[model samples]
Target: MGAQVFRAFRNFNLENRAEREISKMKPSPAPRHPSTHSLLGEQLRHHPEIKGEIASKNDKLLALLKDVYVDSKDPVTPVQVKDAETRQEPKEFRLPVGHHFDMMDIKNIPKGKISIVEALTLLNNHKLYPETWTAKKIAQEYHLELNDVNSLLKYFVTFEVKIFPPEDKKAIQSK
Candidate 1:
C-alpha cells in the first residue's frame, strides 16, 4: 500500500478509497479459531492441536535433558521439578501448630526422669499453650521446681528450637 493511502486508512475520514475498501469488506463470520464470544465473530482458523504437539515435544526434550543431567549426577546435584506444590514458601507454625507429631506422646510422658523429647515438649507447650503451660502450672503439674522448667527452655535452644516470644516476633517484624 502507498504510504499516503496507508496513513489515510489509519485516519477518520471515509472519503478515501481505503475507507471504501474497508466499508466494502464483508462482516466476519463465526470464528473457527477462538470461537468468538463462545461462537460469535469472523476468525482466521489455525490448528490448535499444533500447540499441544509443540508442548509434547517440549516435554520430551526436557525429559531427555533431565536424563542426561541424571547420568552426570556424580558431579552435579540432581535437578528438582518445582511447581506451586513443590516450591511453596516455607512457613513457620510455632509449637502448638505443627502437623506431624502425636499429642498422646506429649501427654503420656514415661515414668522416669523426663526424657529429652518430654523436655522439648514441656518447653514447647509452655510457649505454645500458655494457659496450660504457665511457669507455676507446668512446675506444679510436672512436680518440678520453677528453676528446672527454666533450664529446659535453655536446653532446647541447643537443639535448634529458637523460641521467640510473640512480643519479640512482633518487634523483629516491625524493624
Candidate 2:
C-alpha cells in the first residue's frame, strides 16, 4: 500500500478566515418592536385608591421585616444543655416486676426465630463444642427450622475484623 501524506493544519488560519468573512458581511439593522400598552399602569391610573393601599401594605411589610432582622455583629448564645436530674423520664410500657424471662430460652419468641442473646449463646456453644451443638441439635433445642439453623451457622459470625486501607499509600515514612 502507498503511504498517504495528510496535513491536518495545512491551512490553519481559522480565526483569520472567520474575521475576514465577518468584515465582508454588513451588520443587520436592530429589530423594530411595536409599542405595547401596560395593563398594570392602566389599572393603577384608573384606580388611585389601589395604588395607595399597595404602598401602605409594602411599607408595613418593610417595617415588620426590619423588626425581625438580626444584626451580624450581635453575639449568638450557645444552647443550654439540660441536666440529667432535671430531664423528664420517658413514659413507655415496661414488663411487670414479677414477670419471669429467660435469656437463653425462646419461650415468647415467634416460631423459627431467635433473639440476639439466644443466637449468641447458640453460636458460642457451637464454636466451643461443634460435635455437641451441631445444626440439627441447635435447631431442635431452639425450636427453629433445620435449614435456618444451617444458614445461620454457615454465614453468621460472632464478630468480623476488617483491616481498612491506609489513608496514605505509605502509612509510615521512615526518616
> What TM-score against the true fold does each predicted structure earn?
0.25, 0.32
- Mind giving the per-residue lDDT tens digits that candidate 2 earns over 1-175? 1223234364578789888998896889875453324666677789989978866657787888888956586554443333533677654332221223454333366556667777887887898899999999988787778989999999987864766669877555449
Q: Relative to the unseen true structure, what is the C-alpha lDDT of residue 166 in candidate 1, on a scale of 0 to 100? A: 82
Question: On residues 46-101, what C-alpha lDDT tens digit does candidate 1 reach at each position?
Answer: 55665566566576878888888433434433454334346666543323223244
Candidate 1 weakest lDDT stretch, 10 residues: 91-100
Provide the global lDDT of candidate 2 against the true structure. Answer: 0.70
- CA lDDT, every model vs. true structure: 0.58, 0.70
